[model samples]
Target: MVLANIQQGEKESLRSYTNRFFAAAAEMEDVNPTVAIPNYRRGLISGDLSKSLQLVKPKSFPELMARASQFMLLEDTGNGAPDV
Candidate 1:
């Protein structure tokens, strides 16, 4: 929660956020990487891509997108999503 608030408030401060994230990770009410990871996964399944991406900011955008893609429907070359 502390780190989240810091990140939420200081959107321009990555170094501070990284420090606070680790510092607060152990004490967060429910902000452990494990919990955040699954929320991110569910967000993808639910088509809430923004929330999913916010949960895990990978070093690169492509890697982050690829992580989200694991939970996305594998679209056909024709851009059709097959029946679930």
Candidate 2:
């Protein structure tokens, strides 16, 4: 299957970018986590969650997602804004 390139828009939020990434990734018949994880990280704009994930080194996609979810929650709470 042909997968479209994933990109993070300048004004896009992390949640939006992640949703787009997953949508594109789902189009691939054989999504390899090993490749997907790095690609996901590469597409993200440099930020706290990305840095934290790099340091933690998640072993699987689920772990990486969990970290992202936690970060999103923290970000939302810290900013006092509802997740978009």
Best by lDDT: 2
The Cα RMSD of model 1 versus the native structure comes to 10.8
Per-residue CA lDDT of candidate 1, range 1-84, in tens? Answer: 533343322232223433344455556665556445333333232333445456555554346446545434333132433232
- The C-alpha stretches of model 1 lying farther than 4 A from their native spots are 2-11, 28-31, 37-84
Candidate 2 segments exceeding 4 Å error: 1-4, 79-84
Question: Candidate 2 — worst ten consecutive residues by lDDT sum?
Answer: 75-84
Candidate 1 minimal-lDDT segment of 10 residues: 8-17
The 0-to-1 C-alpha lDDT of every candidate, in the order given, reads 0.41, 0.73
Each prediction's Cα RMSD? Answer: 10.8, 4.5
